[model samples]
Target: MSHTVTDDRQQQTHTPVALIGLAWTLVGVPLAYGLYNTVKAASALFSG
Candidate 1:
């Protein structure tokens, strides 16, 4: 019987900068819009 062993020491995974930026845009744009709308609505209540 023979046993074999394999080692993987230098494996690396990375997300490209463009992909990261796109991901942020996907998540942040709606969040920012919602925040803006909430603030706008809240201001109208206080200002009137």
Candidate 2:
């Protein structure tokens, strides 16, 4: 008697592009805002 092996597995799932873009946007907005604020504040030192 021999045992049989089977892959009875589902395919890998992935997040949609639109969802990924939205997620990135959600994260990037605050990151960009923080960076902008940092730059603006730093520029003040040299502009004076």
Q: Which stretches of candidate 2 lie over 4 Å from their true place?
A: 1-10
Q: Write the per-residue lDDT of candidate 1 for residues 1-48, one digit (tens) a residue.
A: 999987868878998999999999999999999999999999999996
Q: Per-candidate TM vs. native?
A: 0.73, 0.69
Clashes of 2: 0
Best-performing candidate as measured by TM-score = 1
For model 2 the local lDDT of residue 30 reads 100
Candidate 1 least-lDDT 10 residues: 6-15
- Model 2, residue 26: what's the lDDT? 100
Whole-model lDDT per candidate: 0.96, 0.96
**Candidate 1 global lDDT:** 0.96
Q: In candidate 2, list every pair of residues with a backbone clash.
A: none
Candidate 2 structure lDDT: 0.96
